[model samples]
Target: MRTTIGYTAESIGYVVGAQGLVSFASQTFFGTEWGWLHNVVDLPSTAYLGIVAVGLALIVGGVKMRKTPQPQKAA
Candidate 1:
């Protein structure tokens, strides 16, 4: 049960991290530091890398959980 919750949180974190990274990239591509995403989400530049790292760790945890074998159940 805890593993399942971790998987769900990890999935969400991955998506949020991806969104922030892409938004920042898009802003830079347009020759600007401030993007519309900044208006919606207020993540500081310093925290961006940490957020991404956490997201990656969460995803790895989910994958590891999936790979572990489950116990057999009796009828």
Candidate 2:
């Protein structure tokens, strides 16, 4: 159960991080925000990096949880 949750978290983090990176890059490099979600949900320029940071934190937590060994169940 814990491992499943960890994998789910990691997958979500990857998606969120990718979205943030794309949005941040487009705004910073192209001088315009680009992303379907970004267009629908407008946000301050500063918040994009924050989103990325959160995603990174999630990824780390998920990976750590997944790596840790589960305790044996004694019958």
Candidate 3:
């Protein structure tokens, strides 16, 4: 159950991280010309941090999963 939760969290993080990069690109290149797109400039940094955070989350989740014991079948 814990492992499943971790995996879900990691997946969410990955998605957020990828979006951050895209947002950054749009903001950096388009700026105000893109209207609200200018807000995306901070995306690069946001994405970078998100990636790092997600990476750590994955590592921790993986370790937890490995440590978790599997259920045994009845004899």
Highest TM-score: which candidate?
Answer: 2
Error (Å) of candidate 1 at residue 46 is: 2.0
lDDT of 1 by residue, 1-75 (tens): 656866786687778667656655655466455434566767656565565666677777777776677787898
List candidate 1 segments past 4 Å from native.
1-10, 23-41
- Candidate 3 residue-wise lDDT, 1-75, digit = tens: 766776776676556555554455555566522223234443443454564466566656656775678788799
Over 4 Å off, model 3: 32-75
Best-fitting candidate, scored by lDDT: 2
Q: What TM-score would you give candidate 1 relative to the actual structure?
A: 0.56
User: Residue-wise lDDT of candidate 2 within 13-75, one digit each (tens)?
Assistant: 988888888888888788887776496667766678888988898899999999999999999
TM-score of 3: 0.45
lDDT of 3: 0.55
